[model samples]
Target chain A: MKKHETAGPTLLRQLTYRLAVFTLIFAILDVGLVVWTYTSQPEALGEQLLTLEASKLERSPFLSPDELTGPPGARSWSARAVYPARANPDHPNRSGSLMDWTRRERLEHSIRISGVRRIERGGSPEWVWMELEADSIRPYIPVILNELLTHVALPLVPLLALMLIFNVLAARRILQPLRQAEREIERLDAEKMTTRLTEPSAPREVNALVRAVNRALQRLDDTMVRLRSFTSNAAHELRTPLSIIQLSLERLPESDHRTELQLDVSQLNRLVGQMLDLTRADTMEFDTGTILDLADIGRDIVSDMTPMAYSANRELHFDDFGSAMVSGHAEAIYRIYRNLVDNAFLHAPGESPIEVSAGPGPQISVRDYGPGICEADLSNIFEPLWRKDRRRNDGAGLGLSIVKRLAEAHHGTVSVQNMNGSGALFTVHFQEGMPESGDLKQTLPS
Target chain B: MRLLLIEDSKRLASLIRDGLQDQGFAVDWCETLNEVKLLRQLVQYDLLLLDLGLPDGDGLSLVRSMRRREDTTPILIITAHGELDDRVVGLDAGADDYLCKPFQLPELVSRCRALLRRPGASLSTVLSAGNVLFDSSTRALLVSGNLVDATAREINLLEHLLRRTGQVVPRPVLENSLYSMENAVTPNALEASVSRLRKRLKMAAANVQIRTVHGVGYVLFEPK
Candidate 1:
């Protein structure tokens, strides 16, 4: 599996988002506490200062104003004294008595500050004004903010880093079985039906998937075994009777009738053989790594079939070009060449030479001088049971199909093309660098 | 020579048996593995033509069992299984040779003769190809029922080529079997012998001819 860079939103990214949200909530709570305490505390301090100053003035009504001007105790405090003056009816110079001064006079003359409070506590109930400096409350604001940073944000940043790291590790740990299951599935070769995916040591949901896949494979394997058996049995059942017929025919005396019987029997045998070859090509287990010389195989086949070609009045020749060593099953390669040569003999014109050649490219070509295939029939040449015309019907039409299938089994291709002047050319090309073995297993249906 | 044929198909067995008998082999046909097992204990045979799909048991198992008991009789498997693996497995299980089904009678006869040519194998005294016959017992060569004189070396070359009737006989094999190593081997020694043998056989009106398979060797066959 290819590793991809983290460029999008992944599990880890979403985890980081949740961590940021948690930090935001912590900030709101921390800052909200400081703001609430700062606004409410100054008003309570002003009221306490006013009460103490009023009681002091009641004890010493003649205390000098200078005595209360400087700072008092823990708070910066001061007091203000007021004398009531109202219009006199009888004597213009006389001042109104302290008791006679109505509540209206005190209410109109009162002064207000943010941290100041007024109180009336003398025997005559006179009003005293006390205030705390604004600078006194401003200092505590910076102290509270510093305390917040040290206690909350400072430690929280590292804790969040540790949490992020731990989350990623935990996520990978939880997904380990899933990755293992994927590897096991990837390694399973369909050709090797005995291999089964291992039970993932994961949660129950993941195990269920693995078990289901294994069951499906078991069913498929059973079906394959049955199909293989059927093919083998069918070949046996069909060929045995054909053998009996051919043997019985051979026991008769030689005559024109026997010759005809021989021809029909031979034809029947070829058809049966091709039919089985087709089945085997489709279903047989093939392996690689066996090295064989293509030219050597061609020479041997060409030599063996020389007599047949001679009787047909067609000369068969092998144009050897050193050793064309290829990696494939020897039997399979032999069959490919045998089929090509045999097809040429059956279809090529009499008295013409059929040349089988090998090359350095690991290619084998069989050229026959006969009526070249029609353009329309070329596309369907490799299809099973394809006969161009009744006049040319000499086979069951399974030969070329079998050739195509066998070539494909070796990871090769079979192609045919009409020659310029005459005849047809059939070539099989094997890919280079084929694995010695198990390459076919990799291609099996999974 | 005596031969045992284990085959389940009655018609195929009968035809093969008649053909073998005509070829001077005393053939006993058994339709099942049990019959073969019983008959082998009672008699000794020169050859066994076994079919793979027997009624009672697989012919491969029979071959394996016979081999385990140290029986070295040449086993020629006539089977419908002609796959490469099938051939390899059959040979590995102790079969001497294998012939796929739907084979010609002449090829089967030839293969049987070839197998019997091994050392210590009991073969028929009379060997014939085309119109020529060589009787080992009487040391006589007859063509068209008349005696034809031939030298010992020529007879050996002719016999070797005739046994493998249609297959090519390489020059070296023919030369090695015809001459001894102690003799100063001449380049044309085999050629001279083959030329004289060929002319004599032609003068004698033998039905077969020795044709050279160019660059390979010679193959003897009846001209059609």
Candidate 2:
């Protein structure tokens, strides 16, 4: 049987994916802020330098020659003298003999200079040139970007890794009750209708599901109990009359009519017995701890059925391989083989030897050299109340169905196929497992 | 032999009573466990034929209580519930044997006889299988209501096999039962005795068969 899959979206996968996306968004936002702060620093610095110089010029008016000889060749800013008439046409204040110029010559030398001119007031309005070299600050944006990546984004890698590890553990812990519930549900069989799922210690949704399942199980159990009791009572009621009739018949003197009556009673009794067996096959639990040798069970069944076979002028040949151990209920296994043999005896022609065999695969097979089951009826043979030729009133057509159900109850399977040219072969294969010897009940008590 | 039959169905109980009466048993029929409990305290029954679904109460409870009070009467559960679980429960609750409803009269009588013949039972000495009966006290061998002549040694062999009907009795056990410990048994003495007894049973048309397992021993049971 295929195991049930936990389909649909899992909580763990959803949590991990959302968390990873949030982390990525935060990292991008942090990188954007760092780049914006570094790139804008140079422009703000240029504006601050112009304001300081303009304030200085307003305060001293360049008439104080000492101010004209102020600090020169500064690391980021420099000042030089220029005549007012030599100002470029692009200058905004051409009439006042003052202008700001961006020098192209400095760009080739890997330096960008921005000059702001202030005309000297004392002598013929000579311009004092103040220039700031942008490249001389050495690409601070790249350095700042590198620092942000190493100090901020790099640490998040390990954090995300830790989160993933913790998420896996949490997911497994959260799913523990669900996994347990799955196992419990899988183990539930018709025989165990009374068993309920241990109310899962899970989330609200899962708990609700568990409760619903438990309620369904409760209803099912109640129905089964009612049905079983009714069946039991009905069987008793039916058998009571039969029992009375059979007892009355037994008291009568031997006669042809009495013998015929006995046969009819026995046939009815067999039908009732098979009907009960069919019910039992559906509900019976196979005790796996009781392991028995298939060969031994076969031998016992054959021995028990020997007289019947002999009366019908048929032979039962059992090819025993000593111990073909299988884990199952002895009664159920015995019934399975008994039904097969009985079916063979009824359908198969009289006088043909029925061959029974067992092997190490833990498989027992019964073969008969009778007219093979029609190809169309082979599949439906195991269906309850189905028969190849309904004219044969010997059975209620429940034997094969019971055999199938009993085999499945023991975790085994039964199959039937036509043999070459003639007859049919029925085989039952038990699942393999070797429990402790003492754990298994003996097929035949010594 | 006296039996207390507790069955809810009046007709079924009556039928079973008549059958038991025909088998030379004194049967007292009741419809419920309450009546059985009352009647049981007044008179000790040799056996209790119980039906599970009684009118007043479950017969199993009565069986359980009887066992608790140390009542050793054999209980044969005759119930409509023929399920394996029901049978197991009845047996586990101290029932001597279990028979499903609608069982054959002969099978029921035979089961009753087997229970009565248990080693510790009061009716242990009377050996019976099918229509055959061998009473040790009377030293009589009867088949189908007819007295059959058999040697004492043959009777001994039949008694030994009958004691463990439907089960394999080892050769040594049969040999020992056939002769006293002081008597030296010949190599094929047991076999010869078994052969002679088998022939006599066949001649009398006894509804039983003796099967010899080559290396094991012998088993005797009524063939269906």
Candidate 3:
């Protein structure tokens, strides 16, 4: 896990998702409110003007059309007259929307009065529009605004702007603690789990969650200590007893039964050792393996097992393509090599030759001129405790499994395939970033 | 050598005690930390073999307390795990060595001998791994009977590598041995010495590779 690089969802996606939702709703309300105010403005003004004109006519008893002739049809304000049997016949009839169209009835109505008028003789009206022109009414031009910045839009745009800004602040405040916790968690590698996350300055609810996580870490630490203790004791307990057993067997007279018992005891000891390995594997996460020269690993294991190979009358040879390095846990990697080599000796017939080789871009391929593994068994060979040979119950099937697991842990891979002619080839390849695969290879025996 | 063995199981304890005694060790057996603690107050042993699960206490804590008290008796941890999470913690807490379970009796005996013999101040001593030889005190390196002049840093790195002969020594750790805070050494300087050291080492054989594990560390490889 790269500590500094963000791994999953980028922050940009989250921002875009939130901003998009906010914008859609903001735009809808902005357009809706503006249209409602524009349409209703004429009605609100018409009522005031109609009341004033009616009062004027009542006072004069016969007011002339000149009295109603103010500029009206061109601006946010417009005016139309409705005289019962006296006002123009083409004027609106008050059957549909008060101001339906730009200047005519989009509905069935004709006369529609609109007045941005003061009850006084001379004053500016605010806003109005008419569906029809009238004889006693007029259109006057006044201040107009950008369709986007109208009287109806004045508050809505700023309101939308305020919403965007406030939500941004609110989102950041809410996510800040979570982001900090994420960084702290990311930093908690196997090497640094001993450190605790700094308690977040968050709301009461999130603070409780942080405390819970800290408690979990404390529990993990305690459990690891106990596990280590058990591991330490288990090793101590097994080694001493095995030593004693081996010593006791040594005291016994040389006979067929004694030999059988010795073999049995040794097998039991090996089994116990493998079990201990299983437990120890847990603590090995931080164990970045030793940088291994593949040639060295192959040469040592082959030579160590060479005596066994020769006693079986088998020829064991190794070739190298110069120096190749791999990352591996020294002890575990040794066991892997030892196990593979030993397994080869077990399978290869007497007088059969075994070849081992390693080189740069480190790969170890060990071929044994034995009956190759059956094609059907290739996939299952690495399964723990899965033995391909049913006839030979000489051992547990953990050898290849251990090799596979150890190889993967080291950021390498192991595979078994039948050769073109005879024998099975076991290959393990080490990828880059293996415990330490960096410097140029230097060939040296010591 | 006189030694203390702390374990919990009586049956296993008796068996181990009898076996170790026959191996020429003067063994004082205790089943609990209390007994070990009391025994320590009364007499000093050359080494302590402590099982972490002594009935009365945490074994590491006991070792830690012993260290605090300035008791310099070498301690060996007998663990069931072949792998330890932190060697530094054990090393820091005063344990001189660690051994995993189901080990060969001969191996244990040899490790004990190795630990006991480690503190001698003899410059004439030569550590022989196969045909290769390295003298710790004099910083003299020998490959097949030839004396070689390796720089101090090279010798230190070589000695450290030789200490774990047939095993991998992580390059960073070797680097640290060559240039830890105690020795104001830099990586480039270590690299220069390693390059020089490699040249001297390669004179022995061909197809012998000291491989670089990309992005991790380096290990000294000796093919038998």
Candidate 4:
């Protein structure tokens, strides 16, 4: 999808390109129409030229016809004859000889008889016969083209440019809603599954697409709801029986077998609890309004788990650097530290102290002085159900994964590294500052 | 001591009741919240072990109603819903403590005992860790059935540590308990008292020992 988006032209570029293309097409069609009209109606051009010549003759009535007609061999106009009213009273200009003579001359020289005109120049009636050489009009072509350009094409250039600018702006205006929808979609995630795109005032096609996307989001939210409820129900159903078994086991007489069974039951219990926690971390949304102190939570968890650590022949320590305030759910953050400590207890050497510290910043770290993680397993340590020794029943390997998910749900990051000497240190960095209110809604399964 | 246990599951309820009885508590087992209302009228229970999920209604409603009427019987919520939100809600509804299900019976008994040991609750005034015991009413210390002599400050520190056995008690808490707000205390005052108490316990041959968690606090545990 990213490749295609980069490869395709943007809406503004496409609109400008198409507008320029159509403008060129219209300009070409306009020029063609002007040329065709002039060529198809040559008589109109002849009539216009003849009227201009007659007007020039009227301004200078004393000029001889020989001066008006150019030399014979030149490509120019010629005055065939000038007839007075008295010379032919009834139809003076309808003389057969004159007509025949003009026709013969036109055929011989390929001359065009422009027109015949009657005029009373200097108070005397007269008829004039005019003819022009067809080839002589070639010099006038540039003038006609200049006129057409000045009258039509020149004005259209600015108009076309204005249209192009308007088209680009209009295209951007029409797509504004779609850009808004894009931003909303970009912000969508599993936590904000309830968010939907809304663009009622967009164009018909874009609105249709927005509605379709909203419907898809609704379906996804429904699926998430179903999944969360299923997880909750499964947890309740499994935990009840496990509780009964644990209780029943505690009633048995003390023996090696009983202790082994009890150990097995407790391990199973931890696995179930961790699995549920993993599921909740995946689906739960944090309430941004809940402000918690990281240092306080760390101290509380270390204090709470001290008894467990003591029974395991290990010591738990907590270090607080004033109060580290952040926006998060208390229990989820507690779970993260608790899981890290639990992991440390599982790996650290007996009686070695584990340290849990909360911070100079919005961060918490747990360090265990034990055989540090191997280089190969460092990357996969947080993966669910990944155990160093698969045969061992000590842990179900879900604790680290739960820690990672819960940390992420609070907008935090988790990392692990081996100490310089002999230990592994796990650190979680939480985002500081209050999250935007109403960004997410808590939707826990009933 | 008498206690009321509310749970819906019969087998689990019976196991819990037996476990509590073995711990020397007269346990009255009921399966619903309605039976609890009727039982409360007849006998005043020292502690209430209420399960959040019951047949009649949510146990939180009962906790809220009990606290509303000024009844402070020290309700301990036992539930399979172990999510943090549920625990917070339970506590906010006036429950004294929360214990998620699938827990060992020993843990349940310890939590019950802890709640019952609150100042107003009707229970023995004796708090013990391993072979060492501290009587809150008489301010007495006993080790292996022998009385041990200790100063008032040492006994005060001992009582606080014994109350949270096998748990880390922060230095500030111990200091605040040892010296009142008006009294000025030196930085090493708590360490001095702890060392003195440690010597007394060693002389008395008490099994429990106070171990310091560097940069944190101290914990009292029985060495294996």
Query: Which lDDT tens digits does candidate 2 get at residues A1-446?
Result: 35666677777778789878988898888878766765576554444444445446656653442244322333455566665555566667776555654342345545444555564455545555665555444433335545576766788888987888788888788777787778778877767577788886667767888889999999999999888766655655678788778877887999999999988887787677777777777656435556678877777677666656655767777776555887777777788888899899888886998888787568898999999788788789999999877887778888899889888776678888899988999999887767667465322111
Candidate 4 residue-wise lDDT, B37-87, digit = tens: 899899989999999888788899999998999999999999999976888
Weakest ten-residue segment in model 2 chain A by summed lDDT: A65-74
- Model 3 regions more than 4 Å off: A1-154, A179-199, A285-292, A310-313, A326-329, A347-351, A374-380, A389-393, A431-446, B1-224
- Model 2 vs. true fold: TM: 0.62
- TM-score for all predictions? 0.65, 0.62, 0.50, 0.81
**Across residues A85-203, which tens digit of lDDT does each residue of candidate 1 receive?**
43344665545433311111112334223222223444454544444443344434444555567666787788888998998889877767777777777776644566787887677
lDDT of 4 by residue, A1-446 (tens): 12224468888788878887998888788778877776676655555555545555677888654466532333657674466444566764654222212321344645555556554578865556776665455634644566467656788888888988898888888888888888777667766577788766659889999999999899999998898778778877899899998888788888999899988988887887887888788766556347778888887888788778767777777888755777778899999999999899889887898999998778899999999999999888899999999998899899999989888777679999899999999999888765566344443321
Q: Distance from true position, residue A139, model 4, in Å?
A: 4.3
**Each candidate: what lDDT?**
0.74, 0.75, 0.62, 0.80
Measured by C-alpha RMSD in angstroms, how accurate is candidate 3? 14.7
For model 2, the chain A TM-score is: 0.63
Candidate of highest TM-score: 4
lDDT string, candidate 3, B101-164, tens digits: 5445555664565565554411135665556777766777787778876667777877765665
Q: List the residue pairs that clash in candidate 1.
A: A289-A436
DockQ (C-alpha based) per candidate is 0.33, 0.28, 0.13, 0.65
True contacts kept of 4: 0.69
Candidate 1 interface RMSD, angstroms, 1 decimal: 2.2
